[model samples]
Target: MAWGAAAILFCVWTLPFAELTGTSVTCTFSEDCVLPCTFKASSDEVIHWNRNNFIVHSYYHDADDLEKQDKHFEGRTSLFKDQIKHGNASLLLQNCNIQDSGQYSCHPSTTQGAQESWVDMKVHAPIRSVNIEKIDEEVICSSQGIFPAPNVSWTTDPPTQSDMLNNSTQTTQDPNGLYSVQSKVSFMGNVSDYAYICSVTSADGMQKWKTSMRQQGGNQLPSWIIVVIVVIGIGIGIGIGIWIGIWIWKKHQTEKNRDGVGNPGDQVPSGAFIAPGHDHVPPDEFGAEYELLTLWVTQKLTMPGTSQDPSAIREFRGPLEPSLRPDTIVSVTGLSQQTSLVQVGKSPC
Candidate 1:
């Protein structure tokens, strides 16, 4: 049976074959796919590929296969030359868009079989936009519509402080077997504006995509305001103390003036006053009648005879009798009991 199969393959290859039978194939998005076909004998046989009623390529020992030709199939389809040598009539399509996805067939002019492949092309959706904004002195970044979400990072220019980057992922797989993710991050708003980057990488890490955003406006006041207020309060307290001290000094000076403490007339002189002859007078002379008379009557009298005239004093009456007139003066020295009293008469001119 193997020999018969080989003879049938040989007869098909040597002679011309009318139509192709069957082939198997598979395809991936934007990646090289395979369309493998087989025959019983094809050591020297060549193969060609056709797409949708169009002959795209023919490779049979550099011979033309006029039975299959299509103008629309040119330049887009080519036989996998390496695989074709191994009887694998595969086609490698470049830059496969979604529209390029379809069924393709392989035809072997020298061999006796038919092969084909079906591909479903998928386009990786890129990140639309990244936005960063300030949320109460903190920076928050959000990205949307990016299939296979990006890695988020927080960085700075001049590098004031260390950067911290965090990411959150949400994945959803579509019916077409494509994955999508979304992520966000929080950072210091002041430093976040320096330089921030979000990078997206494929599963294989071969192709990387990146985007950048900035945080706006960074300035705030802390506890130093409290310290300033405290300092001002102390200054006011000191000012009040100085004003009270000045007022107290003025009040003390006014009280001193009202009390007459420093007035000269209010103080007594420290000395004793004495008359010339009074020094020899007995100590009891201070209590004698003469001192008493001098203090009470002689000091007040303006008589000029008290200094040098005993006659002046004799002329001055010593005492007055009861019968004498109000102005009369009298003397009782060396007097006897007289028989009769004499009365003086007024002198006539």
Candidate 2:
């Protein structure tokens, strides 16, 4: 297949023309393209337009002559007879397709001799649409109905470190000699978020398409993450509340002590108080010491006690009641090593 295509291209390269005209004229798909030429011939002179010996349009003696025209160009080729006197022998080819791209020549003959001028025609149909698909780690890219043997290539984005890529392409010519191309590239299984680019280029210019096959499951937040966040937030709120409560309690205690509600060396009916000089203590530490002292007194009262026994010197009898006694003083620790203690009396066990 390669050799056959090469031979066809060789023949095209060897095609002859009288002289090169201004420049190659470009035409869009299914549109008209002008193969321009100029001459000083009269309307009475004969003009012949052709592409590599294929009849495109013919005129003789001031009128069109299609008796020898090719069937493919039967009604789609025309010449402007009104402009012939102005030295314009341009030919208009309509509904241009891929096969219409080639070298074109206009031969205008006068009574003296035949003269020719030529221009190349480039008919283009860029790839207007492209589709890409991925199936089981294989990616396929395709574009259809392009013209003039377009160039096709495949590329990967976030380029793979692997030097070798599993890439392949297949191009088939249509009935109109246009092209349909498909490209495939493979990769290791189970890869995601990979992008691919496919491009086609020709004398008409270039066209490209990019695609990826990554799927996003959904937009909602995950249940586990949301649960964790709520739990953490609750824990923080509880911690803050406890801290605030302790601070409020300590502040109240300090205020009461300042007013001499129950200062150390001062006695109260329900309890004896320590000196209120530990103003430098933090609220949290002060609250902890106060709670510890309260718990110690409660525990001692639950146990049996015998006040008459020398070994139980601090013990008191059942039916104990709160009483302010000099020996019942509790030491509190602070700037003065003033420890906090609670007096205890026991019930019958």
Candidate 3:
């Protein structure tokens, strides 16, 4: 009877520790996370947290004893000291990184009994931003700071055959175990005909990011090229304006010379006098006698001092009489209906 009672007591005391429970804990990269543990409240409590046989944290004698803590977790670990008395042995990890992911065991012992629990930890650096860029005949997609690995894919607005994509991808890991991905796709057709989309997804399928771009009418011009075109257009417009101004100035000079009002520096030929009002002379009244009058005036103009003195030229009366017969005027009027002639002695100098 004594042996039977001892066996039953041993089984009863060990039952709580034998029924171990497991839990999963997900932690964000570079953030604080807690590994949960619990046990029945008892006196003389002792708590220990470990991973892969490496010491993470320990507590005994009513205080933390970390003389054997792993170097990797030297200053990054802590326990809920005030809550330990209430059966809480949760481990608080600060600045969680990729290397902290794995299985961890929590052991809590007391005067009543001892128990062990398992916790699986996962550290994830989710996909943050995806970028798409076009360079000449190629399109590139890229992303950085992802955990595990990443999947990259390219698509078009007007979808094409998978074989026609002609793309290459590369993924690299940093010293911190975060992943970075880059992809490039060669384009053969017009850019305006289709839109390009880039998708980056985490390996665990928990995080994803997408970016897209397209050219409206044709391949987009670089900023330097657009600036050059605008500058050239402005230069052409200025050149045209200068050309038009020169043409107008030349036409004005020609009209001035024809009107006998040319510049002061212009030279006049000998025996060719400038007659200010000669353009207004009526040819019908003089008829054959007009040539004789012009020749007589040329002879006088050739004489020195006569060309300079307007009074001397006005004093001489031509061979034609100042007054003409009304019958002669009436006869000239009948032949030329549209002719408007200046009156005789109107000073056609």
Candidate 4:
């Protein structure tokens, strides 16, 4: 460590340069970042950026040259030429990554004198949402697309004495070289006594992050859906009740007919007969047959006895029950012209 420190100090003191302005520039992972290096320069000067003696970027002859640039930084580093005329040779690092965090030296030299400066870069990862879900009835806690392969583990709080848990875990790299981590702890009993937390620590150990599954709220169906379901159920129930009432009413009517009972002003039971007369009845219960018979009988009783011949006042007789009114009105469809010649009558008992 002492040797390493001495070597760095010697390099800094020996360089024909000044310290880079400011402490450090911070950047997010998978983003672009700029390393500040401002100084007056001629378009003819050569500019070189190096990290640990490896060329990160080189500009000479008024253009960039990657012949000596490190393979690790291939196509990932460039210098600002538009501002270079204003003495700005700031380096733009493309797709900033965890491995890119380090000290970089920017040196521009002319025949008169060479000046150099060093800049520090710090790369960070934005915290990702940890997912909590139930798969096949087992609890799962997972995080994805994180940089530097974070450390993932389960914990509980209000702080349990033993912070460790038995779990299944896997870590995989994404296409962009970040990490995806999944971890699940077996849980069968006593959920109320404990709440789970998914904790992540970046490989560099600078970040400690945790997410609580319980704090994210419930996954049950929404309240509006429940309310809609209840309303639909009520509508179905009402429909069923109306259908039952109609069925019962029809069944009662069928049973009434079978037992030889009938609606008001109905004809007598099958073995009985009727004598026509006006019978008072409740309007809603009157049958069509009884209505015709009553009308015919009232007309006959009111007609003048112009045909005084004894045979003209004819009467036909039959056993009659008090409950039935005569209902024998049928159409003799083609006989209208002989109406007076036809003598219709009732027989005496």
Question: Which candidate achieves the best lDDT against the true structure?
Answer: 3
The root-mean-square deviation over C-alpha atoms between each candidate and the true structure, in angstroms, is 30.0, 17.1, 10.5, 12.4
2 against 3, candidate with superior lDDT: 3
Better of 1 and 4 by TM-score: 4
Note the Cα lDDT for every prediction shown. Answer: 0.45, 0.63, 0.72, 0.63
Residues 125-186 of candidate 3 have per-residue lDDT tens digits of 98878888887778899988889789998888888777888899999999999999999987
Compared with the true structure, model 1 gives a TM-score of 0.29
lDDT (Cα, tens digit) per residue for candidate 1, span 241-320: 99999999877764443232323322121111122223222334233212211110011112454434444322211111
Give candidate 3 misplaced runs (Cα > 4 Å): 1-19, 218-349
Q: Give the CA lDDT, 0 to 100, for residue 13 in model 1.
A: 80
Off by over 4 Å in 1: 1-122, 148-154, 159-163, 166-180, 189-193, 202-349
| Reference-based lDDT, residue 255, model 4 | 47
Q: What C-alpha lDDT, on a 0 to 100 scale, does residue 192 get in candidate 3?
A: 73
